[model samples]
Target: MEENKREVQVTLVESILIMIGMFAILGALIIGAEMPPQIPILLVFTLLMFYGRLRHVTWDQIFAGIIEGIKPGIIPIMIFLMIGLLVSSWLRSGTIATIMVIGFKILSAQFFLLTVFLICCLIGITVGSSFTTISTMGIAFMGIGHILGFSAAITAGAIVSGAFFGNNMSPLSDTSNLTTGLTKVNLYDHLKNMAITAIPSALITLGLFFILGRTSSTADLTQTQQISQQLQRSFNVSIWALLPILVLLLLAWRQVPAIPTLLVGSLTALVVILVSSPGYSVSQIGTLLMNGNAAKTGSHTVDRLMSGGGINNMLGSVSLIIVALALGGLLIQYGVVHTLITSIKQYVNTPGKLILLNMLSGIGVNFLVGEQYLSIILPGTTFMSSYDRLGLPRKYLTRTLASGGADVNALVPWGVSGVFIAGTLGVNPLAYVPLAFYAYIDPIITILFGFTLVTWRYRRSGKRPATSTATTSVGLKDRDQPVN
Candidate 1:
């Protein structure tokens, strides 16, 4: 009787948490206050209600839940920390300053404008930061595009699509790192898994951009030359400064852990900084890392582009991550996550249906919350059990989330990625939604893989005939292997 009563209470709590999640989603989409509504949604309402409803859960249990969630986040968090140290070191090392100068020199030429899109794509892949790529190269591309008579919307679309492609696939990217961490998969494995979908999407986008470039008229030569010359005059462009970036790449290639790779790279960049910019001392470098690089480039345009990525700059994202993870823990404790997964699993027993449901849930949540991280975290937590039950590897779950959740925000006009791109490119977000090939291809390909059962791994005895797609009771675990 006591066991039954406990189960009943758990059900009631889950139902209430689900309702709160619904409200939180709705509020974030509609609310237009200065602050994003995700804070209230995750912290104030969801977390408070979760704690209040968990009278049966002790303080130790609650703490344990929070720790459990955060423990998994350690890898991403460590990567972020190293990124901070590296960015600081790189700025001090004069790598960014050099990249800016060289980038400007290219903008001065005639045909250079046409190559800007492709170049951004390459850099995006290398750096794995769409935002950083955009703020740096994207700005230059915009300037060149203006001179070349390309519409800002088209240029922005090209930039966003290319940058996000890299972010989606790059082992160094925070989102990619986070996704792998959540699913307990290898970073390289996730990148390799994505190529099945990513390579095709990129080729199509490149072809489209090639056509767009040909159709657009060239901007005035004099204006293009003037911009390029101005860029060169602003910063010292040296090939030696680029060594740190090469070093950074070599570390990633060796599959060194992100924390150490970033730490070594940052320290190397700082050594370069001493060689290039003797204007500042060691103490000043420390200050700059904490406060971000304050560009004294004297050109407002140049300054705005290069001045970013200190420990201070990462605070907003850090705060949001901590809060969101906390709420995720609360939801798990209140049984909200289990209830949703169990309910969804009952109707989605087959591998194909399970994959489809995961994709839709991820996309649906992205559209509702207007934040990319939650779209991933909430849906990932909500659907993990389903993957385990279906004998699907957690890697597939992680891969599906990346395909459907990570970059799907680029499709929604108001999503964090969408809004930022729109603001940066000086184009309406809605205008470019249809043209974003990568954003569209992700979910479509993921769903197709599900139905086709292509590249599926399965346990020996539980294997269904090639023609069979029936539900099984043997229990699924990853691509292969029976449930333990």
Candidate 2:
């Protein structure tokens, strides 16, 4: 068990200062200079490595730190590439177009926001990807809302809220699966536990949108009509177009893994496109899958919304994840994270305090590193022994990671999720932050519940639950033992 990497002793204050410095630099770069996050993150990483060496950490350990941290995210990056392909394929097949047409047909302008939220919630769970839902359905909603005289920010907010709801709860989601796998939690049980806070937060978000939506003007049916007509002209939008989406939903419902399900979705879309589009050459179809569909629908909005996908589009976000993970690896392996977390022990002693700490820590990672993969992995791994020691059921730990990590990333303008959503939905990430009601609300609700101990499996005897074996890993217990 001891393959012996050198440990560096770092003080808590030094760790906090390092965190503050990194984030402060990031904040200035993002808010003041409006520079790409990659630059600032690169600077932070360099400075952090220099800081580590100054404290007597070896060069080999420094490199090892980043590698260890990023190892967990390799699968997520693959899943993201799959999401890009899935979206592009679905676009070519007219699956998303059909859904948009159906949405505009059923939704009155007055109630569009709520519908977007609910439908995104459904598709999010079905697809198990916030990025896919936002890029496809969220873009459609943004276009329709802009024409309808609704604030694009608000529309984006609803999209973020609903999309992440599924991202957290969907058994097929990479984050959902990653959180469970990291914490040794069962995916289904994790979903059940998440509903305690998620459903109510969703209802609240829905009601808020419903109230705000009343102010939305009646959208000119022309935009919707033009888009729908373009849909028909560019690709065959028929009931048959629904095949890929239905297949995706079916695969997800049957508990298929993400990579294969996405592969199947892509293949389904390919077949649908080949059969539906008249005389489309085999080479052309191959090109579309790689370079992505170019929607030249004459309608700018339609072109903008439908014209993106393919693995190429996912590289920016994937690079951000890799870099962020490398930074996290440095902090963790070198004891910067350990020092800071250990220093908080006195102030963050209670379960409530721990929840607050985890939330803030997850959010902190999001802000500093600008990626949710780091957010979830850093907190889950950092506090694993702490939760075990306190006898807090690991489900609480997993839920905290999801609440703070998965849902919190998009709230920051510079975060990886934030940048991607802004680019895809054509909305400003900062402007939409306040409107990302569900993303922000989930963490707050989790913290409040911490203070009251509501819906939490509090530690009763300073021991793991009977079903949880010492060697069995965390979050694997059949049931949480409630505290008195």
Candidate 3:
């Protein structure tokens, strides 16, 4: 809200044209041309900088925006590194191997995909981190997918769906908390409001995954058995190997910060490895920590499946995120995003239309800005005045913000969530987008229910008395219930 030291006066259309051009070029290069996304995105950043300079904005102001925008992503970048460490350490300690060994035995081949989805959901909710869940158990599921002869794309989809579902719904999740905090909605109320759409979407997604699992599973037990035997031969695949997962869960439940918790998990696994395998020396452990796990188990299948992790493995994703954040910062500094959304606000006169516009705004900003947090902050701030005028509970804003914006981030091929997920899981985000049922479904149902029913009403006499600033909350209830 601070007045800019320098401004680049850009028209709405100019901004739109630039964004469309960027997306089109990015799409062509990444998909049609089969190129990595880094170059195309970096190109867009250069174009934005050029646009800023054309408007006579100073280099300092422009870079300031970039710095502030990228500030939020530092933690995520650090966590990505920790994930590299965790996955590599877990693999070395046989944690990943044990999960696969037990998973193949207890889980029916027909239910494989559903289990991946559900387990990821549980871990995501518990851990409150999609990236961590994906890097850890999600990686294991990839190996299982290969063993079961399931399509990699669909398998990645199931994992992404589960991870995002947990991320959206859990109180521990940063995005979930960010959504509530930004809208000034009570966290509990925000979650309760999300249930109407979230639950149905989850059920539908679950059903679909179940069907996909049934049809796609070839149940190649020979591969599974071979993998299991190789894992057993290579490392100590036992209940002790699972202690590291328990350590992570406990840390999450106790509300420890993610970095420290992951550090502990990684260190714990290292200790476990030392204890389990007397032969693995400090040099070997150091090598794994720096370079990631390398499996030379003589079985190419096991080697390929288990060979992912380490700080080195995560740097590419970390770089992509930092770049995206820098771009977001630049856009915010120029006010390009704000102007574009404001231009659209005039057409949203009716309540239904307002609801739809709100959803679209989230999605729009998600694409424009390439970061999930901004998707919530931008649209939520933009529409608060409108919501206040309508006397709507703030929870509606928060719910729609999360489902419409935050959830959609992972589905955008060039966005932060998409880039991170794809890079971490070794699956192209575009390939997984179709199957990432939860990510896309959240927005559809959030907007659908918004038009058809009352998302949330103040608990009192249902009158907050319209104001342009703050609104009163008597409490909140679902659509069917009268605003008691």
What TM-scores do the predictions have?
0.69, 0.87, 0.93
Which candidate's TM-score is highest?
Answer: 3
Tens digits of per-residue lDDT for model 2, 307-425: 87778877877777777778877877766766765566556557888789888888877776566887888788887766665666677888899988889888876566887787667
**lDDT of each prediction vs. the true structure?**
0.62, 0.78, 0.82
At residue 433, what lDDT does model 2 achieve?
A: 89
| lDDT leaderboard ranking | 3, 2, 1
Q: Which segments of candidate 2 are over 4 A away from where they belong?
A: 1-4, 171-190, 216-218, 370-374, 381-392, 413-416, 453-479
lDDT tens string, model 3, 107-173? 8878988999999999998999887788888988988887898988999999999998888888998
| Residue range 166-230, candidate 1, lDDT tens digits | 77777677778878778677777778877877777777777776676666655566654554555
lDDT-better candidate, 1 vs 3: 3
The runs of at least 3 residues in candidate 3 whose Cα sits more than 4 Å from the true structure, single-residue gaps closed, are 1-6, 455-484
Candidate 3 residue pairs that clash: none
Q: What ordering of candidates by TM-score runs from best to worst?
A: 3, 2, 1
